[model samples]
Structures are given as C-alpha cells and as structure tokens.
Target: MNLFMSFLLLFLLYTDKLAGLNFNTDVTVTWGQSHVAKSRNGEEMEFKMDQYSGASAQTNADFLFGRFDMRVKLNSPDSTGTITTFYLHSPNRDLWWDEADFEFIGGSSTADYKIHTNLITDGIGNREQQFRFPFDPASNYHTYSFFWTPQQIIWYVDGIPIRVYRKLSDSRILYPDKQPMKVYTSLWNSTAWTGEVNWKNAPFSAHYRNFYVNACVAWRDGSNVSSNCKIVPPFWFTYKLLPLERDMIIRMREQYMTYDYCNDKEKVTDVTSIECANNP
Candidate 1:
C-alpha cells in the first residue's frame, strides 16, 4: 500500500509540473522602433505610442501550427485607433513563403479583429477577413488568443472563442503547410480604415499594457533549436492543403496580390502577363 501511495504522489507532482510548463509566461518583445533588440524584452519595451510615430512589438517563436495568446490594454486617451497584431514572416527567399496574422485595428474603445493569409511564389497570394470582438479593449486588459493547426484557425476574445476558420482553404494539399513564423504585436494608427472614428478627439498617446505572449508547437519532424525561431510542427502535415493545387485559392491570392501591388483590383479577363496573372 505504501509503495502504491508513493507512486500516486509522484504522479500528482508530475501532473502539476506539466500543467505549469504548458502555459509559460515567457515574453519576448520586439519594438518597431529601431533601437530595440530583435528577440529580447525589458522595461523599456512596454507598449507606448504617440502621434509622432507608431510603436509595435513582436515575439520570436516561429512555428507552423501552435497556440498564441496575449493580454492587452489600450490607453483611453489614444483610443482614436489602435492596432495589435500577431504575424509571421519569411526569413529566406528561396523557399516559398507563407504568412498568417491576426490584427486588432482602429483606435476606438471597441476594436476590429482581422485574419490574413499570404502565399508567396513569384510575388504573393493574399486573402483577408474581419470580425467584431467584445471587450472595450481600451478600458481594461483582455486576453486575445489564436489556435492554428493543420485543419483550422481559431481566435479568442478575452478567453471566449470568437472566430474559427475551418474552411478557409482552397486546396487539399501543399498550402505552405510546413513553415515557421514568429509572433508579433504592435499598436499603430488606423489611417487605412478608421475614418468613422474621431481621431482629432483622441489623445496623442496610446498604450498597450500587460502585454503577454505564449507559444507552443504541438509536433515537429525535422527541426533545429534556434533562439529566435522554431521549426514547423509535424502536425501541419495533416492539412495537406497546397494553395497551388486549388484553382480558387490560387485565383483569390493572385487577385489580391495584383490589387495590393499592381493596383489591379478588377479581374482582367484576358489581358497581359497571362503567366503572371494565372500561374502560381
């Protein structure tokens, strides 16, 4: 009986330790300002911005599929528009690049959340969608989170699941399924979309406080241990979604890329650069 009880005690202790490790509070802040380190954090990096320029911060963990969480509080006076972002980038140009992001934009007591995806070959294939989230993000600190896996992408507002994208794919395989992306956050002015809000009334200063970030990779196959980046998790293999294979996803990405860079918003039914227009 004593032996059995001892094993039980050990099991309980291990469980507690594992639970603690799963939700670590390690924060790495990267400021948009040039002075900040690329993957380190300190008191000076706490979120604060003014009219002169915008301030932003990002974390270093880069993974293809994982959970990302952060708590943010916006300053009331600067509520004209605030943008909190989570994004990933391509370090090298040789490999086709893939990126996904969650954006909290507009400087109001209320905020709008957006999700964007980009697949890069010659240029970029892009898609974006938006939704509303509760929490007067300017008043109090609230947790904003995302869960990305091979099959779906989910978002949370203050711990409540607000959005889920299970069908945002246009292909069944090769959708940049295996790629690494770092975590990023920033507070910026919403000049692009906040025309409805009264910017003049907003104080020049906006703040993001109690900023926190946590990341974990559910699985990995061939990965190296790097300080600022992580290898793509193995689970992404399940997605089997290749943007190039799907006609619609590829078309959508091409349209957006043309519009974003070439300013070609209209679909050119039969025009120039046929290869550039339809070849992914």
Candidate 2:
C-alpha cells in the first residue's frame, strides 16, 4: 500500500476498535461541577482548579478488566503545586482497595512536568515509577492509556508502551483482579507531591478528550442478570506484548525513566518483590 493509504487504513482500524465515549452518558461530574466545562457537543471536557477547589469526573459504571484511553493536555506554564490525573480506582475503600494511576506533576515550566505511575493492591502501594516527558505535554494533547487483564497491566503514552507489570509465577504477590474499578479524571492542587504553589499562578486547567474504553462491564445487582455477563472474557484478557513492543518498552525506560521504587535500595530494603529481582 502507498504511504497515504497505509496511514488511512491504520486510522480507520483504530477508530473501529475503540469508539469515543460520550461524556454526558458515560461519565458524571463527581465534584467541582461548576469548574467543569464540556465542548464539542460533550465529546471534550476540561477540568479547572484554583485556590478554592478542583474538578473531577468518573465513569458511571464499573469495569472488571479493560483498556482505557484518554487524550489529555495538562496545565500549562507555571503550574507548580498542581496535579492532573487519569486513573482507575475501586469504589470500595476497604483494606483491599485497588488503583492504577497516571499522574502528571506540574512544574515551573510547561516542559518540566513529569509522569508518575503507580499500582496499588490490597491497600498497599510502594510501586512508584516516574518518567520525564520527551516533549512539552501541555503544548498538545497526547493519548495516555493502560491495558488491564488478569495477568498483567501495561501503560502507554501516545500508543507506545512505556511500562509493564506482570503477575509472576509466584502467587503470593497481590494482583488487582478481584475488584471492579471506575475510570476517573481530575485536576487538583497537591503541594506535598508536586511543590509549593506560587498562589500567583492560580486557576490551572487540564483538558481531556476522546475518552475510550474497551472492557468487560460488571453486572449490576438486578432481578434478571445474565450469566454470560460474568463468564465470557474479551480478546485482551490473554494479550501479551510482541517482541518489538517489549523492545520499545526497554528503550523508553532506558531513555526517559527517572525513578523506580524497585531500584531504590534505601526505601525498599526487601528485594523479594518480583520487580526487584534480576531479569524481572
């Protein structure tokens, strides 16, 4: 195929695979509704944060396992002390609560931001990994995504796999397979994690568009729930990374990764975790 035809074919296939979600029907503004705005007939949404409050939205239904994607442009210049996030979180906040996060920590300049990723299982979370963006994330929208299944979780930036967490042969390591989670997006201030805010640069904003989800929806409590809803699995349930994709992940980590909890000897004295083991 010609270059133009090949590009067009790929675009068409991707759109067919993951259709865009409608904001009005698929999600609800959980907090700071006044600061949230929708455009492009509700296909695009923006979250604004200030000294007083921030904005947040969450998916209306719970999903067991899936691939979730969002195009995001973070808070711009002088956004210190702010955080923009897209994550999946369990509604139950009990001892076994689980979460997966993609947090953008704002810095003094648009190009200075960092991507912080973490996975929490059974209410314990120390597996923090951070990476520096290759370009200014706030300058344009980029697709950030994660694929979750029974065996592994993979994080992506602009469709490039950046990180992977797999369930090892050892069964002792806790995985987030049991709980159903809801997708969420938020823009908030967090001086503890980012940095002390210059209140002069208040009213930060983050834009999110082209939300997509391809996953198994959990069955709600009802009189006529179907058995198929709880049994059948999707193709992604057994997905594994190709050799080329694995090589790309290694290259991306080598070049852009800033911090990894497993490699921190001071903070993580126990090297028993699979991620800490050689060749893991």
Candidate 3:
C-alpha cells in the first residue's frame, strides 16, 4: 500500500482508542427493525430489503464536520433495482435541508453496477455524479467514505478520492456547513432511477461493518454550533489534496466516471455560478 493508504489503515486500526463511536450505543434502527440484524459481537450490521419492506439505521449523535467511513458488501448478484445508501442528512426534509449521499444502484450484472453520488444544500440538489466500480462490489467488502469539512466534501472508494465538491463564495452555490447531520444507511427498492426489479431474487441484503467517525459532534438542541471537542480544529478540518492525490482523482474520474450533472447543459442554468465551471 502507498504511504497515505498505510496511514489510513493504521488510523482505522486504532479508531476504537481514538474516540470511535460504538455501534450499539451510538446508532439506532430507524426503519424496518425486523429487517435489521446484528452480529453476536455487535460489530457488524446487516440491512435487508424484500418485496414488503427495507431497513434503515441512523446515528444518535449529530456532527458538523468530520471523516465518516463504512465498509459495505452490497446485495448479492441479481440485485436489480435495489438501492443501498450511506449518507449524512439533516433532520429537516423541507426546503432547507442538507445532505450528502453514497447510493449504489444495483444492476443486472456486476458490470452494470453504478455508484451514484449527490449533495444537497438548502434542499436544492442538482449535484449528481455517478461512477462504475472496476470490481464486483457484491463479491466482497469495500470501503466507501467521505470527508466533510468547512471547505470541501470529498468522496472516496477504498481510500481513493473520486469526486470533490468545494464551497464557493457565490451565494447561488450553497454549502452544507451550516447544519449538523446524522449518519445513516439503508437498503431499499427503487426502480424510478434504477431499472426494473427482478423479484425472483427476493430478500436482497447489504452487509456493513467498521463504522468509523472522527468528527466534531454537535449538540442535540438543533443548534448550528458544534460541541467543544478538545480538538477544536482537527487536521481534517483544514485538509487539502496533495499533488499525488489530485493526480489520482483526475485519473479515476477519467477512467470510472460515467456521468456528472455539471456537464448537463439542460439542467444547469448558469454554469458559471457553480464551482465546476471554474474547475472544468
């Protein structure tokens, strides 16, 4: 492994001693309790989806900024029309909510699987980017993670950065810095965006393990301020991409990216007002 990845692995190994939250104490099943299962040690969790219902779970604590990571093995093969999601979301569902998503849309075959990502600020979400995994995501567990700081939101697949969204000065492009969000994961049925479902492969399931978070926890009073974590400003709060990492991001985007909403002329009104306008 490279130096960066080695360091990340080391960090993950010591996560429990470095303030990692407990799964049973910090997380709770929010939907389809019957469909959510835990291991004998409570270190791994599973979410299942059937023709009847799907399962979801969320963290009890809210966070303002931090690095969130999850190792997931998507539903087994023939998982058409199923969607497995890991995301951070504000409590509100109206015009002023904030969210960041990592949604895996199941396909007919391993080659057809799509990793769809999106961000929403002030409830206006047109930022959608999709990529294809080189390996079969259902075959084994792969780490899907993201870093949310004051300046940028970066998506990563197996510790490799794939996409980034920066906070721009333009008022037209709002960022999610103002709201505290809770981490959530779910497995559900959806065919509107994904293709038709094959109920023949019923009872689709997703496995999750190694939930790690090193972030500024926020209070529960619905306030916009974060709690007084001793690390006032963690290294990640001001983290920037290194030259090598930037190069990797470019190469990955060119090779794996299938779609980017910023490139859609019909959907974006004034492209100049968005961050991608300058980056592209």
Best by TM-score: 3
Cα lDDT of model 1 by residue, 107-221, tens digit: 4344433223323322244334444444465666676655556565545555434334453333422333455556555666666665444556543333333333333432334
Ranking by TM-score: 3, 2, 1
Candidate 3 lDDT, 1-280, residue by residue in tens: 7867755754565354345455677889999999988886768999888888999999998888888989999987888889999999997778899999999999888788899999988988888889999789999999888888889888889888888888787887788988889999999988776878898898899999988878888875544465646355765567766555677778988999999887787677774346676442
CA lDDT of every candidate: 0.44, 0.82, 0.83
What TM-score would you give candidate 1 relative to the actual structure?
A: 0.53
Candidate topping lDDT? 3
The deviation in Å at residue 200 for candidate 2 is 1.6
User: Least accurate stretch of 10 residues (summed lDDT) in model 3?
Assistant: 13-22
Q: Residue 91's C-alpha lDDT in candidate 2?
A: 77
Report backbone clashes per prediction: 17, 0, 0
Model 1 misplaced regions, further than 4 Å: 1-45, 90-96, 107-126, 167-176, 196-280
